[model samples]
Target: MVSGTVLLLLTVLSVCGKAAAERKLVYVTVLFRHGDRSPVKAYPTDPYQENDWPQGFGQLSQEGMRQHFDLGQFLRNRYKGFLNESYDRHEISVRSTDYDRTLMSAEANLAGLYPPSGRQVFNPNLPWQPIPVHTVPQSEERLLSFPLGDCPRYKQLMNETEHTEEFLNVTKTYKDIIDLVRNKTGLNKTNVESVWSVYDTLFCESRHNMSAPDWVTPELMEKLRILKDFGFRVMFGVYKQQDKSRLQGGMLLGEIVKNLSTMADAESKKQLKFMMLSAHDTTVAALQASLNVFNGRQPPYASCQIFELYKDDNGSASVSMFYRNNSKADAYQLQLPGCALDCPLEDFVKITKLSISDDRDKECQLPSEGRDKEVIISLAVSGCLLIFLIALLLGVICWQKEPVSSRGYHHVINREVGEES
Candidate 1:
């Protein structure tokens, strides 16, 4: 009787293990902005330039490093057993942008995620060992360097976005401040995108506790504070564009879809556990915009946007998104295209496919449309002309060993057409 019972238990365990094997596990992708730093730009009247900060501007501070380590520790706690105690080549990968802050931030994160362990830490008395983190130059970077704002279409979309209801609303709300900025900056009115820049400079300066300008009155500063609070809305939520679903939003969808598709193609049927991306706020905004799951506020420093993949009981893939930021304690959940909290990857792709815009940003184009369109039309016409010429040449050959004069005439016509093209 005892032997029979033991055999039954073994059979049950085998079945459970098999079921677990079929239902692929989890994969995670984290997209994060660099940690806090001094402002990227300074106004003409600003006191501190790049020299004010210890490492100068844009480098990660010690505070930023500690913040990322804590986050990495948080991730370690979250994925303790899933990610090996030591870095496993097959199980994990980290990609970062080429900036010093981003690269250093990634290193700090790795420090927390995979600390010295077991054999790696040779000394029982001290724990320290070297671990590798990978990165690519920003220009050549693939995974972490997407949604490049250099596209002409994205620029046009941004221009349109600036005219959206939300933008207009903000402008109306801050008209007086806009006037104040105009009077202060004395910039060309035709090229006045810098209205917002003044606020950005002041706010960043304030955060770093830099000395304020004397002209900045208390009331004006308070108004700037109000505008500062509106930063998230302006950058993400309130900024609207009819083509945003395609230009900005679709860019993000393309990335998520690409990663998921790559995994789907893998023969191992390995559950994707992590997708870490070190990127910018624009990257975050574009992604959240595409997902239609934005938090109304812009993603802040070391703001990690996580997409966790999972499997249902039936062995299907599911995905979920979460946003973590320096400003927020809790990670906010985002509703993916399909499959609920644990959404299936297939559904996720399908919903995203709809947001992709074909033209992206045609309005931002500076080059003449006439030339581009004409080139296409002309090319088609030329291709047809070439085919006609070839056919004519063949006909002439078949007619009578192709006379030199006739061939010469055909050659001249081809040359003329080529020159015109």
Candidate 2:
């Protein structure tokens, strides 16, 4: 009896171990904001201008390089067991926006994530190996960029958003600051949307230890920060957020969902282990907003959003998300709104489909009311043209039927006939 009991216990233990081992990490996709950089531009009348930056406006700083490199190291440590010890081009892919800052950030990050190993080392003295960071021209880039300008419906939605009660309240609350900034900055107009530039300028200057003007105080800066955060909300949320997402962030989300689904398939030959995206804070915010998981704050420099796909023993797949906004802390897991922390892959896809659009261009067309007005105008103009054409044709027929005696040409025709005879 004792021997039989021990055998049953061992069998149960072995099964539990096998079950645990069956849950394997299959694929990972990471989208991270580019590291710190100088202000994209300065407001009019600001002391710091484009020339003040080391590499002019919007260039990445050395500190930015360090931040990304550190983030790369963090990633290396986090995925030490899963990722190959050496950099394998086939295992990972990196893409960045065509901006110098984002490209440099990706390169810097790779320096940390994949330092030279044996054959990859071109020079013993130089530990870094070149890793290609792919990008497309800014004009052609749609994925990984937020609030794309080409979508007419998105623009219309934004215009409608301006009139929402929440938007109106925020605008009214910040009217004084808006007017003050307009006067101080020499701008002709400054509203809640445009005032964020002032805050960004000040925030960048503050980060670089530049002194603000006498009028710019701590209290005012705080208000500006709030406004800046609200500005992000305005871009991706605030009103009809899900519809706006379908036109904006959903584009990228759809691609991610596709990638996750592809990885979930057991027969998929895609051997890619990790896909890295280096983009701006707005990109991160846009994606989070589409997921209905945005925390209503700007994603800080080097903030990373991670998606991990895992396969279970029963051939079922699951997805998990994590956000690493702070350098010192571990990436905390983010649960989908309706699903658990480890959401089933199908459930995730179903929930996210609400934000994704089947045809972006079709969805971007003018709303029904606007389309109806345009159609009505078009039909009226076409009807008038048709009526005028019919009238012209009737007048020609009437002229042909006029009596020949009434026309002097009749006499001319008779004379010509006599001459011919």
Candidate 3:
């Protein structure tokens, strides 16, 4: 009996140990914006032009490369044992937008994450191995880019959003700042939506310690910064946020969710441990907006959003999210609005469904505009009346053209044969 009790105790301990080990990380998907780059475009009155940048407009800077490299190292350290020490094409996948800055950022990031190991090193002097980074043309990039065009409903939502009380109030409050940017930047028109680009160019230049015009004082920059943040809020969420997300950010979220679901499948041969996306700040913000956890600020250079999947011994899968907006700060945990940080996969899907559209194209179509609807109805009614009038006129013309006797042919035949009399 004593021996049997000892054996039972040992069995229980072993089971617990196995359970703890089984609750291991199964898959991870990380979406990070490309690092800082030269401004995409310059304002009309700005001193810096496209020619001023070393690589011209929108190319990644050396600092941008360094930022991504550091991020890659952070990822490498974070997933030390889970991912292979060296790059494994089969175990990990990477993708980026088809822009120079984003593509180069991915390359630089990969260099740090998976420095060629042992025989894989092609050159003795340079320890770098080529890793494939996939991308679609900018026109077809729906997965990694946000605020995608071609959705009429999304456009309608945006138009409606601008008219909302909150949007109007913000716009009214910032009218003075908007006017200042218009005058300083030499732009013909400047609104809440259009001012961000101006702010972006100025902000990028400021970061590089470039001198600005006397009109662009520190106080003016602060006001522009606030407007810039408001612009992001308008893009992602201000009114009908979920509906907008269904068309914008939710598309990418659906793909991520599908990938997560695929990894959960026991029969799946693809043991894809890591999936990485290199994209823009809008991409990050749109996704965070869909999750309803946006921090209401622009995601800085090399900012990352991480989704981690874990499975336990009972074959249950759960997901956890983290946001790393500042390199200097550790990633902060994010929870779904109504769910726990480590929410079950099923529950996660269910909660996220509110933001995901079942029929994007159908949802994108605008309902008939009120004035247009009335016009169409009036035109249809007029067309029916015109047809009826034409038919009546034709009948009258036939009666007028007919001979008196032939117009009542049956009566004429009866009189001629004397049958009716």
Candidate 4:
């Protein structure tokens, strides 16, 4: 009886170990928008200008700092077991766009994420310690910034999208509001794209309890908000969204999928546990759009998109996503289109491959029509050159066949006779 009991106990322990090994969280990547900030810019005729802001335009506010700090603490609680109690630089990485608001947000978040403790405390008066946040200059930033201007094909796509039925319908529906905004804001133009600025300026002003002009009413504000949301959709969706994503957000998505693949490899020496990205709402929206999961609403301040890689017992890996747009509640799980809530890493990569461009520069070349025109011109030029070459060859052939051209032969003989004399 004792021997039998020992065998059963050993079998139970083996099963439990296998269970623990299944679906182990191996890596996490969190991409978050910056906290609240002043509007990037105000309309020309708006009452508030750059001077109206405390720290000038586009700067992070105190509220923004608090929001990010709280977010970091939330992260701490959520990843309590996964993350170390102390900061480990080798285990995690933080990168942000080269903007004041994003940079400051990263700093504030790190303060809450890795508050100096016990022996590591440098300043006794403060609860924070310096943590490194990496960034690239805005001109060189492609991973986190959306709608990069370097792609001519993306620009052509936008122009094509503007002429689509859906785009035209939205434009026709908002013509009245667009005109009103143009008049009120004294802007040269107020198309769907430019109208977002009007909404952003008013939204920021309202958030801070600043009184708006008489022309701005609650009804108008709601309409503007809708238009602003539509603008974002137009930028990333509504037409050829997947193709657009391949050029824009897919770049970031590609990097993320690559990281997940690396982490999934048990033999990989990469020991990274977390990667934190601080960027703008556009970045968040762009990424979601690349995945075909954007909610079509402006992501709130400090909104985060989480990607977790889990290793299963069979040496396979899977990915799960969550969105933390609401601070009061837990992040909601997101299901990838054509995938379950917990998607296999292979499926995730495969489904997303269509969105990722193999060669963005090559793909961003002029559209087929433009390339066709270039080909036509090139063919025309080649034809002309070919005709000239053929004519020259015929001329030489005729000259050689004309009994050695008596006049040319006599001239050559006269020159040789003069040299002999």
- State in Å the error of residue 355, model 4: 0.6
Score every model by TM-score. Answer: 0.71, 0.86, 0.87, 0.87
> TM-score of predicted model 1?
0.71
Report the C-alpha lDDT of model 3 over 130-246, residue by residue, as the tens digit: 999999999888888888988887888889988999889989998988888888788999999889899899888998888988888888888888888888999999988899899
Predicted structure 2: clash tally: 0
Global local distance difference test of model 4:
0.92
Positional deviation of 298 in candidate 1, in angstroms?
2.0
Better by lDDT, candidate 4 or 3: 4
Per-model lDDT:
0.68, 0.92, 0.91, 0.92
Q: Which residue pairs in candidate 3 collide?
A: 153-364
How high a TM-score does candidate 2 get?
A: 0.86
lDDT of 4 by residue, 30-49 (tens): 99999989999988888889
Candidate 3: regions farther than 4 A off: 1-20, 369-421
Off by over 4 Å in 4: 1-21, 368-421
Candidate 1: regions farther than 4 A off: 1-24, 122-130, 140-147, 182-197, 214-242, 264-266, 269-272, 326-328, 337-339, 357-421
Prediction 4 TM-score vs. true:
0.87
